[model samples]
Target chain A: MFPRPLPEEKPLQRGLYVGFVALILILWLLPLFAVMLTASKTADEIMAGQYWTWPKHFNLIENFQAVFAQTNMWGYFINSLIITLPSVLLVLVFSTLTGYVLARYNFKGNALVFALFVGGNFLPAQIMMIPVRDLMVSVGLYDTYLALIIFHVAFQTGFATLFMRNFIAALPDELFQAARAEGASPWQTLRHVVIPLMRPALAALAILTFTFVWNDYFWAIVLTQSDAVKPVTAGLNNLRGEWTSAWNIVAAATLFVAVPPVTMFFLMQKHFIAGLTMGAVKG
Target chain B: MSELWKRHRNWLAPLLFIAPGALLFGTIIIASSFESVWISFFDWDGVGPKTWAGLANYRELFADPQFYVSLKNNVIWLVMFMAAPPLGLALALLVNQQVAGMRFLKSLFFIPLVLATVTVGVVFGWVYDPNYGLLALIFNLFGATAPALLADEHAVTFAVVVAALWPQIAFCMVLFLAGLNNLSPDIIGAGRVDGARGWNMLWHVVLPQLRQVGFIALAVTVVGALRSFDMIAVMTSGGPFGSSEVLAYQMYEQSIFSYRFGYGAAIATVLFAIMIVFITWYLRMMVRLEKETR
Candidate 1:
């Protein structure tokens, strides 16, 4: 194995690896620290410089109050939750079922269908953007939450299916066959057998999808205008405009938009990394 | 009733599961793409009556200088953005060296992806802020008045692309780390025994096995750059007289801002055509690679 790490080298490499990860992680989180610090700063102090100094007053409450009072902050948050929750649910259910079907069933054009979904997964949003937009408008779904949900679920389905198929395919077929022979119908098998087994992947997908749908800016901006349907990403844009001069309030609002996904990423960091890196390693 | 349910359940259950996602996908993605194409052939403002444009929209797109500028910027995006994968791979290879608190560093590097886009935009906006920003701060340190990277015609697109590339490169690095983790030690052992080492071993042995992951990394980066709508929408808003507009941002401006639904659709159609080439080829390659591995 090109020699296992020598006894002496083991601790050294371990130390080295940990140090490297720490440095890189800090660098990655630097902008976030800047954002957080700015959010807590008074506008006057921010303009006066010494941005590195700890805030004397931590005007976070006042700034947040002003942000909510002046901007579409709450509207954006509600919009994001409304749009993201249903779409996440839809992607999870459909993708898992589709994966289950293609994995369990030896049907016609199975490979072709799987390929379409996988291919669509990687298709640039640019390709789907125009057509999807036009279709939404023609169908009278534009400027509505449904328009946003439809696009998010449809597009994300591609990636979700890719993950699910291989996972389902890789499961020991003995389980599926034994259940089938024992009079377990496909529906029953899928529900009672496969669905329970798919919990880990489903958990990963749900969290990942939530972050994606919530962070999404392009579709949200295009499909909805009024705060009635605006998600946080677009709301931040509007917030930037209204709080144009109040850097602190704007920063606070941006932090609020950031917190949910950031919290999800931190809490689910391991699963996030694992899910993202799936299919990455090769023999 | 139970027997009937069981008998029909086979097709019906999957369909029931499939229907919601499929209906949504069909209506929004597939149906919408087609609608955009149809709309592109007409001359319809979003809220107004439609006029038949035939191929006129396409012709206008062909003749429009700004369209070419946008397309050219996309080309620049596509080509230069390819740098992310190799850079990420290089970084992964470098930092994968085990050391103290390497964990913290790895997570730290990924912080850009976790930050709010508005924050990244504003922070970088300050970083590139024409006056009294980080860029300006550097210029002051050097005793020069800095030209606004975002405002300068020649520098604007490159500046935005660099910002976009920040998170993407980190993403690429993670992919490579995942690839490296799964790299077979057995193969490396053989290479070492055969007197291969270091760069030669990496290039001849390690690199070849990493092809699939590499392809994937490249494809994702390209797809991201092509659909790049954020930094442009935020930092400069495609300003400095629209020198930095790529198709995605332009499509937004056209449809949403200008309310020229038909023209916007046309731009979208063109972007879609370009994307199809890359994504189809990526899939075809991945499938072929998968088959070869099998």
Candidate 2:
């Protein structure tokens, strides 16, 4: 609107603008389009150097099947779910509680506590990598799904707390004051008032956390080893090593690993964008 | 118990609510950060007994050429990644229309941000393949040869960074889109009455209003650049002979594969030290924003 909308009578100009945007979108997604093309091609076509062409022999299904048959892709998918869901749930619970308290309470060291969450969330994972891995190993949880779960919950809670606290703080103060005047306990207020109002924020947080925990590769590699516990991201990497020449199969596997998060994004675009820009744009 | 609960629940409840998250965050994130710094001064191979090697790891790191290479690549990432915000703003402006099907187009543009970086890396690795990649196909159309980007050490980091930028750009675009939506209509109307249009409107009236979102985008980009490990790991594994390695990947390689936990921790410390400057700036800005909102 700042640039001013084109006049409705100028149909040609609007058409041209849309066409130009379409062209840019095509260019922007060229890599992904190439992968999709590759995923549908037969290995023979790929070997014959027909990457960008329509496949002479379509083998999308076969390539997808090969990804599962050759590697632990299915097991890894399940492992990712196992690790990601519990982590997301725990992060939600912990952050909601932390967010509620930090938002509604007046206390000493409140700012410092909030700062820790914000600061810790921003630090590179590499800085804490060695010690976190060591801690997991010493606790005998290394190479287990719980290792990933615990670590994700602990780490993601930082960002989630920041998000949830901001959202909770923005709620109308009058509601809390009224509840307090009625002698409703803190837990009752949270359970009845805050919880009901927090649905949208929690939904956004869940989707964000799910994508993050599912797509995690660095911690998955650092914390776990066996195929039994590895997530799809790491499993897809292993498939890359195994099927080095099978670009079609590797591309198929890549899509498989990417499907859940992409689907979530499409299904909940509004919440996802709201959650993502919460920190950056103060939405 | 009920009377006691009713009397003390105000202070007690907040403390109880905060305990779990605080404890978990404190130990795993905060405590490990300190532990990483502590481990940097010792000699250990991840699984064995630790030995004190005062200043030895730091000494070796300073003498190491690979350290410089990694440091230089990090600078490259930081500099190259700065393009995301402006590019994102461009894309946001381009799509910020109230036309038919614009929603679908915007969502399509956001697809890259949701896809795993591992997936993006793999796809881009294929795209850069000298033999049968999209680049090769495009080159063939022009009767030119495509260079194997990942295979060329000089071009490897650039290629990887380009792939990473796809998602980073989308992220910044989302931020900018949100910012653009929140622009005050009155301000825009005033600017219009003043006869500000097109580039003049954007440069004067619009750009200043976007300063806060721009700062956030810049901070996020800096962090993304520094934390670039997944793409490097999946695509090159810090090769064509370790030329594409950034500090994050170098730290991982030293600790996990090379079994030099101490050396890795030292590298981690250096990276953390670099990040502390940005982290402090970001924290101050965010805290200030929080206070302003309050």
Question: Which candidate gets the maximum DockQ versus the true structure?
Answer: 2
* Tens-digit lDDT track of model 1 for B1-294: 989987798777766765665566556566666667788888877766879899888898889888988988998888889989998888777676544445656665665676655556766775686655556766888899988888788899998888777788888988887788777888888888898877888788888978888987887888888877778888988888889999887877887778787888898888878877876788788778878777
* Candidate 2 clash pair list: none
Residue B285 CA displacement from its true place in model 1, Å: 0.9
Choose the strongest candidate by lDDT: 2
How much of the true contact map at the interface does candidate 2 reproduce, as a fraction? 0.82
TM-scores of the candidates are: 0.91, 0.98
Summarize candidate 1's per-residue lDDT along A1-283 as a digit string, tens digits. 2123334547866666566556665565555566677778888987786465689988888888877887778877988899999999989988888888778777687787777677566555654665666567788998999989888888898788888888888788799889978988777888898998887788788888888888888788767777799888888887777766666787788888878987888788777777777765533
Relative to the true structure, candidate 1 reaches a TM of: 0.91
Computed on C-alphas against the true complex, the DockQ of each candidate is: 0.49, 0.82
Q: In model 2, which regions exceed 4 Å deviation?
A: B290-294
Task: Write model 2 residue lDDT over B1-294, tens digit each, in one string.
Answer: 989987898889889999999999999999998899999999999988999999999999999999999999999999999999999999999999888889999999999999988888888888888988888988989999999899999999999999999999999999999999988899999999999989999999999888888989998999999999999999999999999999999999999989999999999999989988988999888768757756
